[model samples]
Target: MKIKKILNNSAVVVKDRDGEKIVMGEGIGFQKRKNDPVNQAKIDKVFVMKDPSEHQKFEEILQLLPEEHIQVAEEIITYAEKEFGVMINEHIHVAFSDHLSFAIERLTNGISIKNALLDQIKILYVKEFEIGLWAKELIKEKLGVEIPEDEVGNIAMHMHTARMNAGNMQETIDITTTIQEITSIIENSLKINIVEDTMSYERLIIHLRFSVKSLLSNEKNHDYDEKMVNMIKENYKEAFACAQEVGHFFEEKYRIKYPEAELMYISMHIQRFYGRVIMS
Candidate 1:
């Protein structure tokens, strides 16, 4: 490998034997300066930039990002690569990278994009909270660390939020809100109720999942498709059935109505959260 360009002390652009390919890394060109030989051991990963112009444009965008933003973007990229197995080069598409940068920026600025999406985020958040609680219990049982509940919840919230949003705030919020509003109407009209301690989470999860599926299937034609309206209505029927199951679950377990407010709150969360899954 040979040095193509030095992006920064910790990063650089390089070319392989095939020639003119762009590779990114932290220490690829550490010892050697510009126009110097690069050791193969130091090379991290090589990528064929199909469009040199696109690569240049991407580089320009990165240059405009603040150092803190860059750091966050790196963290997101690293996480996606390590956990989700997304190649670094492919992960840096304009939409994906831009969304990641914006999300991190919002987090740093103390803006809860979660609230913006309303209900979707809320349901996912509850699931996140539950997962956190479960993780904490497992940690205590296995390692005896007794992790703080708040810390677990916070970490889980961030993880789930990041996953659902694909590191994009606005998109996540939009999808979430749409699901929330639609589900809320179904719950209200059907007169189903749920409780926090008794089957509410399960019910909310079912409704949210179905609602999101419905919305995504017709999201593009949301405004014009009469068929979409029909699909939404059918989805509502399924959601209502989930709600009824919750009511039944609660009635059988604790002999109570469990209040409709719990489902309503979950609806709020679903309505506000956004983002789509990136299929591999």
Candidate 2:
């Protein structure tokens, strides 16, 4: 291999044996003086070939990118390969590359992807969000900085996308909308003027979490074995019971029947949750 153009001490564009333009960086091959024969042993990563004609374009743009941006790009590529089995070459699209880089930046900055429903869903989904959270934490620990939490949902969505084929983008949007409805029901039904110190609201939130996660996971995976299906039903029953108990608590505490709108909301939530889990 020979350097076709050097962007900086840390990055270069090189030509492979097939005469394809390969993006090479400092950590990729053995360290050597300029013009020395490139050592294959030190190569840290390789990127997919953009059209050969774009080599000049790449070189020109690369020169203008900040060193930090380039460094973060390299780090994202490395982490994707090591953890997520994503090939660097496979992510040549500008959007994918940028997304991965931003995710890394957030992770390095100590930002956690906080889902308000995370605690609630632990029992039903076994904390699938934890996988994304843990990945972020690992990056922070390794890079010695906190990752921002703003894009946690994007990361989780991408991870979910990788796990299953949920059809087209439209289908995914519809499914997600349905899931939100169910969660909203549980949230509304739990609203009661109970003593501030009571744990009823807390327990209700936990149940809602499980219901939402089960719905999401089931939709994403598109598979539910007999045992898993049974588990979901049991969870829904428990969640419904919890909702009813909260309603009763409210009626007794407030000296009025829980409004019919609340029951309608609860029914919608349960139905939508179950529909998503079963049909999606």
Candidate 3:
């Protein structure tokens, strides 16, 4: 790989076998030149993107945010991508940088803003929230400032927005709030934690995500087997009862009634969750 362009003393645009990549490290670009062989051992991070537009936006982000903040954001971005097993939006290069920069500045000046949705974020996006907490550690390590824990939820929200490709922050908040409510009702009714980070928990999250979308869009699921619903209700009595409560909870809050079939499937999902937690 050869250095194609130098962004600063610590970062450079490099040409690799795959394509152009922006590599970053401590003093990696210092005294570097175009077409010079890049010392692979000195490289710390690589921003590789298949989308040319995203790449362009990334370059813009590098220029937009301070290199120090960008470095922290890069670590967080790498961790989030690996943890979530998804490609986060390139906008995060800008969104996350801006947020972190502001956060660091505010903390320096002893100004703190409490995240109103902190609790909801923890419950609804458990994985992201955990990553957010980890982010606080990195921020403190690199910046020498201890930001309040509430900042984790705000950080997680940005990462969640990047993953969801959400058009607006409010949408993530709205969906997160709805999912939190549904999950709360389930946990409260069933007296279980839902055991975050398990396959059953993943399934539960997926189901709740789609269920909220279905209800919000008024997408009526007309096809349902009455016998199947009855069978589930009889065999998985406890799970079915919890699912029924979930349905009723939604009805009371959203004025949306889940179909009997939807409740039955929810019961099946809950049953699978119980089986997993019990074995563990």
lDDT of 2 by residue, 1-280 (tens): 7765566555566766676454555654335444455556655555545565445545554566544555554554455445645443332323333565555555556555654433323322222344446646765655555554434444444444433342333343344443344445454654322221234434434444443334444533233355544454465664455446545654554344443334333443454444444554
lDDT of 3 by residue, 104-158 (tens): 8888999999876665576666788889889989988987878787899988888
Off by over 4 Å in 1: 17-19, 27-34, 49-54, 66-72, 85-114, 122-174, 186-198, 211-280
Task: Quote each prediction's TM-score.
Answer: 0.48, 0.45, 0.63
The 0-to-1 C-alpha lDDT of every candidate, in the order given, reads 0.48, 0.46, 0.81
Backbone clash pairs in model 2 (N, Cα, C under 3 Å; residues 3+ apart or in different chains), count: 17
- Residue 224 displacement (Å), model 2: 16
RMSD of each: 13.1, 11.4, 7.1
Lowest-sum lDDT 10-residue window in model 3: 164-173
Predicted model with the maximum lDDT: 3
lDDT of 1 by residue, 1-280 (tens): 6677765444556666666755545555457687787666655545565777866765655455543344344444455455544343443543444644564455446654333333344455665555556655654554334544444544344445455325444444444554455445545644443333334444655555654444344433223345543454354444434445544554454354433443333333332221111111
The C-alpha stretches of model 3 lying farther than 4 A from their native spots are 16-18, 85-90, 164-170, 177-210, 216-280
- State model 1's lDDT: 0.48
